[model samples]
Target: MSLHIVGGLLIKRFGKTGIRSVNLLRFRLAQEFLLCFILTKNTFGKIINKTMSKKPSRFHVDESDLWCKNQCGFYGNTAWKGYCSVCYKSLTNRQQSSSHRVHQHASVEKAVSQRQATPELSYSKFADKRRQQSKTNPVKSLFKSTKKDKSEVDKTSSKGHHHLKSEFGAFLESLSRPIYEDISKRVQNFLSKFKLLPVNSTVETWSDAVQDFYQIITEHINVDPIYQTLEETAVENLQDQLEMYLMNRLYNVVFCPPNSNDEQEDLSLQKRIRSLHWVTIQQLEANVNDQDIGVRIALDKSIADIIELDTKTLPKDKLACIVESSRKIFDAFRLSNEKSEVDGGPQSVASADDFLPLFIFIILKANPPRLKSNINYITRFASPSRLNSGEGGYFFTNMCCVVDFIEKLNAESLNLSEEEFDSYMSGRTTAEGVNTVYVCDGLRLIHENNGMIRRLKERQEKYANSVLNLEHKLSEFREQFDEQINQLVLRAPLTLKPKRGKADIDLDHDIPHSLPSPILPQQISNSQI
Candidate 1:
């Protein structure tokens, strides 16, 4: 107050310069006061501090008890800008149910802002009148009906690219060229048909699944199962689920003797199977069961962890409880080859029949978010190149589709708790929350994807652009043709060049050119005489 009074007095006593100085002092004083108030150990002060710190703050409030969690599942509550700070008076020391409050999370505000910015769909009078005419008009009634053909199955099985069997089907019959909006809508509708695809997914929702898919691939092959039970259905079922999710067809693969391995003849067959997204992973003996100490230790540790964390109360000493394994086979994937290239071919543990199953188990139990981080890290290191050289010498590209499947599953089930899962299984809720079944299917899809990628790469060399010297080739051909023509023209010109010392040789005055050879001896003899 004293400072303000002095400042006022100075301003009143001085000219414009003094007035400017006083105003500057006043602004500084106000700012200093605000800073002091914020750091004053008051809840309201801190809230004000945070609000003032960020841009576009209108009002401030105080909260003593606000906590935020950053689980990525829920759509409505992610913090877009930064932290979520709550201001509470805490009138009563007793706790209150946090869920009851209407306080806005940062994401909520961001969403609201976004929603507000978007324009509403226009409802024009002209468009409305045209729509109304379709209902009332009698002559065009037959054409106006949106009803689809009833006998689709009876119709040719070789229909359009896709069928419009469902009302919400993507392939709507139309004469006009497809626009971007229509394409987007059609994609959404088609994705809707995949029963395994998350029902709640929007058109762009599949994009979010990309990262998760990669994560699944990198780690699934590394996960080992401890139980010597040669193999069990637990992991198999999950791989099957993965296959179903991706709709891959190559979910089962077998590499037999020379003649039996003839399936690679038609490359596109593998692709078609993979498009459906089910594939059985193939392994070669060399990759999985390397006799190196490092390999054994890694596999052993992974299996130990799998058993310890997943199976409850199982004692190691109980020989019958945990049956052990046989032989030199390591039923898991590893970087078996020294290089991506091979003289005969790159060897793998395809013979280890149990490798695929063990790999699947490791994948499902993985912390998905962490797996995503690792897979992405690998991709970053593996920069794009002309030859698809192994960046980290990893074979999980096709395997990554598992991540995509898990993502969809996580998205669908994030709302459920353990109790909810129980209720769901019990049919108290109509939706069954069993995610394990679907995970196995995802594994199958990963294998199929791997096959497809190989096939696609083979075909891409033809269709995909390459730097070629077409212009030079054409130019060379032109030059050769032109040279030949010029030579012919030059000979003709010589025939036309005025016969310098000799009489003009025309067809009528045919000179006896054949006698010149015989005349050599006779003419020489005569000249000598």
Candidate 2:
């Protein structure tokens, strides 16, 4: 029966007892209002306003209030009235107290009683308790530790990170220049490191691109394998541009950096390094089978030369041009691998385009004491192998994910306290070194949204470790070289043992040249489509 009907029936039963009946109706109405109010209000509330009534926190409410309000079966028995569903009928007898009052008027009296307290805790005592509690609670401790560490990384990455270095900042915004000029500097850098090649693909000036292509083809004939394989006059329409690009790459390592610590230099360097690896694997033509040690050495020298950017042999104005030339070679190698990918996934292809920055990749592959900051960078930012598929066909790959992770981690590092930050960076424990005994493990928590990427990264960790070993060896070699000679004397005493080779120039001898490979706009059109 409805409450109103029940009340009316009660009133009819107690017809002569008007005052008591009216009191009963008022009590019942008040109870109903309280119940509805309790249902609508949030189960938990901050102490927003001091209650005139002695209302208990909902925590003390019969546990049903703790159950989600949206669940329709909200109810409690006499012993657990106002409790959550789980605790309602299951409440122990101790939960019920006869002193509990239903009326707000009675609640006000209890509120006054609540103001009295028997105990007071000092600040130091509370702090110690909190510390103890945190130490014991793994979940809370982990959350706090993560937040603290993340904050520190964020603070540093936001402003003071290694990308602030100058050479890096300039590389990002490369200016466009004459194509022939760029090629000259590229050839110059290549010759300085690798033994001299007599002729690279020659460029020709023509009224139109086709004529230019014809002239380029005429120059590289009989020199490169590509030309030798083709019917001499039949492939005459092909051009020298492709040959020119291929020759430049085979000769040297080129590096073009960006103008942004803001763009993240350490990150860019790592990406470039990854690209360099892919280039090594994907770009070397099918025919030229060179030893890895020789190629790696050449790459190391090229990268060192590029980084030095010295202008004694080349004009100072040409320094930027030299770097730009290297960038082109970098781009050319990238493009060639791109071409290789389109050319029927040829088994003959050796060097592939790098997805990472070339110089950075070369440096890392050289395997020396990596720029500590760089290692720190890769550790934090570089995406593992999880970021790619065969779409670009391993062109860009997953290096950028590593870079992005570092950036995110940088943002996250801001929460670490000074001591925590110090420990993270140095892996040092204390004056006694007790805490430092364990290998400091850093975490890279990728966004959950990239679950596939996360799994991919897990697999790449091993390969990355291999690359790190290579880097360490390179670092050791550089250190040994540094110990042998000072910066000013690049060469060791020539008088000690070595003799220079004398070149015998023969006018009648057939000097080999690169074969012509054409870059017809039409070839790409059919392939790209």
Candidate 3:
């Protein structure tokens, strides 16, 4: 039966029961059931309508010609602006070419008009006029020379190309030790105050404090009499030095603050990367491989450099490590491409698309210690100008994007089936039947064995040389001994002496002589008698 009919019957029964509690409860339940049924019916209806209202396939033909409008005899579709894909592309190209031609014509006409409106002077005539002027006004020429020197000086100053060593020396001389000490002391005091705060404080608070201090120091450099003699560029450099000093002092407290989840995030990312150890170069479609020793070395060095970020205490040093690591990756690909060309393979330029996956792979493999904390620290505490632009900024941005990509990675990201990805993630299978963990372990073992073998060979060579030297020394000693024996035989003759008396004989050198003299008095008297 329909829910409406059941609901109506329940309500009618309730009315006939004279407002009994049980009847009222049954009526309420019937109302609730009817309301749910109505909602469910409307929802299903909308779904069916949506499914049925979908537009037909683009290739579905009505009364229109199934061929290209230009009569190219190729299949066409209205979705492609009523043209085949090729024709549409060609049409767009022709339009672009025509527009380019018109633009070039207009630019040429404008250039011709501009040329006609201005007076043209020949190079020789101009040179002659300059020579006559110089001859007529020697003082003017000297003034011009001075002006030219001044202009050159201005250019050099504007370009900020002053000799760094000289400028830095002058800056130090202008701002004496006392001034530098004061600035450092103030910075330390500011940092110490922040250090006294609870660990739960946000990184943004620290960043703002640092930035404000930076502005104050910059203003001081500009207005202080001690810094008045310094050049604008020197003042800027001093500001940079102040920033570095501040960050170095704050590195301990602000970076990976005690209350933040940075360490946990690092661990999670590291675990994720570990699980994805089976990812290979082929899957990433990167222009690198394990077979290329140079590429392998470059990748390994890059990983080492990135991992070294955790050890760096300064933001600038950390940035340098990141840049170095990125450069290694680029160099690896460029060298790989060159090698590929030499080997008769098609050459292609490596772009961000190729760089990203490889970099992501590097991050996954490196699994750098405190990866999240390092990235967050740099992003939050590093100089804003450094992160906003330039090569460092570009590469660091890429690093950030790669990290984010790794965090959000799924089967679709890797272009693998969901089931396959799940299997890999769950450790049920791996790429090419090789687990990444095992591969790393095996490589480490091989490296250790190679080092051991090399050491053993070196020791063997050293011992062999030692044995040869020992043998030569032994022979020399034998020769010297024989020569000495021969010389002794040639130079001296041996003789033996007979003993005159028993007491005189040296039968036992250890015994003393005149032993029985005192006790022999009576014996001597008896012998005499």
Candidate 4:
């Protein structure tokens, strides 16, 4: 059955046939070899087909590229050729995801193109549009439109606006309307009921009336049930309002200024008026010294109590209003040069300018934080010009001296004994006195310095101005000298006149007849000498 053995039998059988049968035997051997090759190829092809027909395991499928390359039983799509349909869809998101990315790119390109086309549009417009489109939802534009509508509605529904002048006018009207008549009447009735008023008391003795009212309230608070209801009365909260009213009236009567066209002057006047109370209170304290010690102490205590109570009790909004109104009024007062003779008997009142710094001091003590923000305003008001001038300078220096004293008073180490603290607060070793020493020392310091710093600053400014003026003068002198030199050079003869000969001088020439004696006129004369 071996090809070699079969071939040997055929050749032996053919050897007897001689040379004529040789060709025929060779052709038959060739046919047999071709048949053997065909059968072997068929058998191998069947085995290979059988092996490939079975599905590969997951491990084999992952490791071998041949299965996918041959498209063996895998049905999944692939992006590449010879891959399954499933793989192609997964790799490309069934091709739609790829189209979606392309679509997004196109949209971005379109937006960019739109932006580029309208180059005149500002960046804000593009930003606004982009912001509107930034939301992923399709309804974002609709929401934006609705939001815009709502904002428009809000704007349209708001209350009408009033200018500062108009508002100030309204406030003046309200103030002028007799708001205190009822309270004044109440005070009168209460005083008459108690028979506390003097036999011939009148509204002119209002201070006495107020004092008596306070004394009665203090005396009867525990003993009388009627007085215990003081807090429940309408007048309970009226004290602050009354105090503010009185202060306003005082400013109006004493320091009210005429209108000015200059805006800056107006602003300063307003600031000073706002600050009037500070100075007025200081003046009041000074006047208190003329009274008996008991009255002085009582007055000071009452003043302190009122101020402290107002600070604690007044609503923030009302306080802000009062402060703003005071500022406007102070601005008017600050520019005022006019002085009115106040009706009070015999005490010479200080000028409003003298009180300005004191007013600021009071503000600092009452509400330090409130003044913190307005420091710039205060500084501008107390600037070099104001400080170098008359009464303002005096007051400003005094205020600074006070500040220096306060700084010193607070200089003691943070760990202070109780007695030391009491002494510090009272401004004396005795517990009865409240810190008068600090104020007294500050006044003493003011007296000692006596506008020294202001004078120094004035000198410094003057020197600076003089230096600038000297520089200008020096420049002018140099310019004038240069001009004179240029004029002298222009006027100098460029060349000497040609010497005149006798015959040449006889010829009609443009020489002057009046020649100097130094020059020989006869030699140049037409006639011989």
Tens digits of per-residue lDDT, candidate 4, 74-148, equal: 421121333432343244355777799999999999999988785665888889889865643321111133556
lDDT of 3 at 344: 71
Give lDDT tens digits, candidate 1, residues 1-529.
Answer: 6668868787878866788788888888888888886777586754566456433211111111111123222111111111121111121112333543434465688788978896545667668878876555221121121333212212322232233233212222321233224433534443333223432333222322322342343244235332223244533433333322221110011111122212342233223222322111111112333333344444444435433322221111111111221111243234333222233333332331233333433444332222332333223221111002221111232223334433333212333466754554454654322222223447536655766799999888755543245666778999999999999988887445655786565648655787565554434566687
Query: Pick by TM-score: which candidate is best?
Result: 3
Estimate the TM-score for candidate 2.
Answer: 0.16
Minimal lDDT window, size 10, model 4:
252-261
lDDT of each: 0.35, 0.35, 0.67, 0.39
Per-residue lDDT of 160 in model 1: 28
* Number of backbone clashes in candidate 2: 71
Model 2 error, position 493 (Å): 99
Residue-wise C-alpha lDDT for candidate 2, range 1-529, written one tens digit per residue: 6566766777777785785866678688879878986986653232222233223321122233323233434321121232322333134223333334345657787677767754456887899989866655221121132456334423423232244323222331232233233334543453232222112211111011222332333554445444455564434222223332322222111111121132254445445443322222222111211222233234435445444432211112223322443444344344444554565432222222222334333333432222223222212121111111121102111222223323333212334466754564453632221111111112112222255577789779878998999999999999988877775465644457677887788657655667566566644566677
Residue 95, model 2: lDDT of: 35
Candidate 2 C-alpha error for residue 75, in Å: 57
- Decreasing lDDT order of the candidates: 3, 4, 2, 1
Residue 245 alpha-carbon offset, candidate 2, angstroms:
5.4
Q: Which 10 consecutive positions of candidate 2 have the poorest summed lDDT?
A: 198-207
Tell me model 1's lDDT, rounded to 2 decimals: 0.35
Q: What is every candidate's alpha-carbon RMSD to the true fold? A: 32.9, 43.8, 36.0, 44.7
